[model samples]
Target: MTAVQGLEGKMMNKYGYGTDYYGYRKKFVVLVPSTNTAVESEYHLMKPTGVALATRACVIPSIKVTNEEEFVGLVKAIGDATEQGLKDALSCEPDHVIFGYSAETFWDGKERSDREFKRYNDIAQAVGGCNITFGAQAIQDALACYPGVKKIAVISPYMPVGDNMVIKFLEDIGYEVTAIKGHCSPGAVEIAHEPFGKTRELVQAVNSADCDLILQAGTNLHFAELAGSLEAELGKPVLAINTITFWHALRTNGIPDRIKGFGSLLSEH
Candidate 1:
């Protein structure tokens, strides 16, 4: 369903809006890369009432790699594959389309990320003939829910260089990104396999007193499980890309701002 319809539908479900004759169900379709198992599950859990969400997996054609050159190529290629996925998603006549993954858009820099996001939309418009949202763009929208949060601490499973790129992007956009902690995994594929238990440990390790909020950067990393609990433990906002992306997509479609038991940010927004 479109964000507006999604929100209205949810409100109607709880408060009863148009009860004339069982109004049409809202449908949201996501195009997720095969490697990204975390996003779909998170979206499903966070999905509001009356929103029927579906996923169409895109072939990776390869596993995640950390080698700089290969990483660059894979990221670009994923965008290409994702465009095709969007085309397929359009076949379902979804109200809106979501890229369903992060990092790929920010592979370059601030300008690069912006360009890539626009590029995705343009490509999707040309191929799928519909508008779509990227994870990075979703984060930007989600941040609006929490005003005056300038200092952010990033937790990631990327290598130091990859981490550096993300920090730079945030800094360019005005966030301090005061601290960062990454395993600098041997490779991107290794990051995909990084144990969720260990990821929780890293998040705990990097969280600091200076930051007002914590951000988990990669969509592929397992983060949904800790979102609610971590916010309660830290007493600070914690936003994972997966969570923020879905939140933004729903918001853009006009979904009401109430999604409880997910995170404090959702509660306050």
Candidate 2:
């Protein structure tokens, strides 16, 4: 054998990861902010047999975000907490990680998103050599599944600054964001508390006949269950960040189960 092969032969053991009878197919570590209330439950609701999720939360002292500056600060807080969250999650030796925060993923644009994903991925590799799935990349991938989709309408639980970031990111990735709106929830925790009626209204307000798909930002905003119904009514895709990210994680790891009722992104794609 070559020198590389000889060294690899004496390397660390592959611990039979994912041999857990429960997660024998694949194991996922889902990283979310402590302020998030939707990711874990939404992911659990969609998990297939033999797939397991271990959720690790990065605690942020403040969930309050009443303005643009505060929202930016919240993103910084999540960034600082995420590294340690990844380290703690590595204890379980998961096969992959799903980053369940949407704002950071959509902060700058596609290129920036790629760099951030790589930053977290490098951490995963150094510790245990696993991979990670990110929201912007996942949303981009989900949109790619529909080759004909280009015109997009977007809704979020952010103010103008955050929504603008998401819109610019979408455009950078080659989608035409025809219209966009934000629920502008007062605080991080309040993002999940935004009532269903307001979101559905925002969906209609942002959508147009020319729109090909509707996108939702903010993983903490509760929209997974509602996406399917919106699609049924609109005759187009409604891609929520959490659902798309979870779908991306499963598909990236080679889990091919067809999950139903969540929208075409899950059931059909």
Candidate 3:
């Protein structure tokens, strides 16, 4: 083998990681919004053998976000609760962290996203050298797997303001957002209550002939399975935020599991 390939083979383990039994392959700490109810279960569904996941929710008030002001407050509340959430999650001594919230990562575009990732990394380093993976960066990495992808359609459980932020981040990274649809879910918890049919409706609304891919945001929204199913019917790739983030976490941590049924992002790429 080449020298680099030899080094990689030494690093990639054949058994569980760290000191856990269940998380024998890898131990992952996932942080989500306190009011969210979908992310943990979705992560479990996509979880591979010899992997373990512990979810910590960043506490936030379960209130309606009808306007931009309340939406901003919701964002602030998640921010206020995040540091403590990370500290609590670190007690498990996981190998990696998946920050389940997507808004902050896409808030001010790529520069701010990079800064926030570094900050989360610093916190993880303080405890035991674990690193963090965020949705915006993960989605970017997932998209890069398809070289011809240029225009994309987006769906999010966010307000118009929040969708604009997602658009800003995608555009900053040189992807053309062909269309976007935001659910404006009444509250944070309500995002989990969103029905599965909404995904098909949103996809139909935003997808165009020229669209190269369809990406769904909102970790709390249950769309992972739907993404895989839709790809078969749409004849293009559909990426769910949770799957992309978890996939990124798994691959970057030296877990080369080519899990199927979660779209080509996981199964093929």
Cα RMSD to native, each candidate? 5.4, 6.9, 5.3
TM-score of 2: 0.92
lDDT of 2 at 204: 90
Clashing pairs in 1: 1-27, 1-28, 3-253, 3-254, 4-253, 4-254, 7-255, 66-188
lDDT of each: 0.72, 0.88, 0.87
The residue pairs that clash in candidate 2, if any, are none
TM-score, per-candidate, Cα-based: 0.82, 0.92, 0.92
lDDT of model 1, residue 249: 68
How would the candidate models be sorted by lDDT, starting from the highest? 2, 3, 1
* Number of clashing pairs per prediction, in order: 8, 0, 3
Better of 1 and 2 by TM-score: 2
Distance from true position, residue 54, model 2, in Å? Answer: 0.6
Tens-digit lDDT string for candidate 3 (166-268): 9999999999999999889888888898898976898899999999999999888899899999999999999999999989999999988788788999998
Mind giving the per-residue lDDT tens digits that candidate 2 earns over 47-139?
Answer: 886677999899887567888999898888998899999889988989999998989888888888899889989999999689899888888
Q: In model 3, which runs have C-alpha deviations exceeding 4 angstroms?
A: 1-18
Question: Model 2, residue 232: what's the lDDT?
Answer: 94
For model 3, give the RMSD to the true fold: 5.3
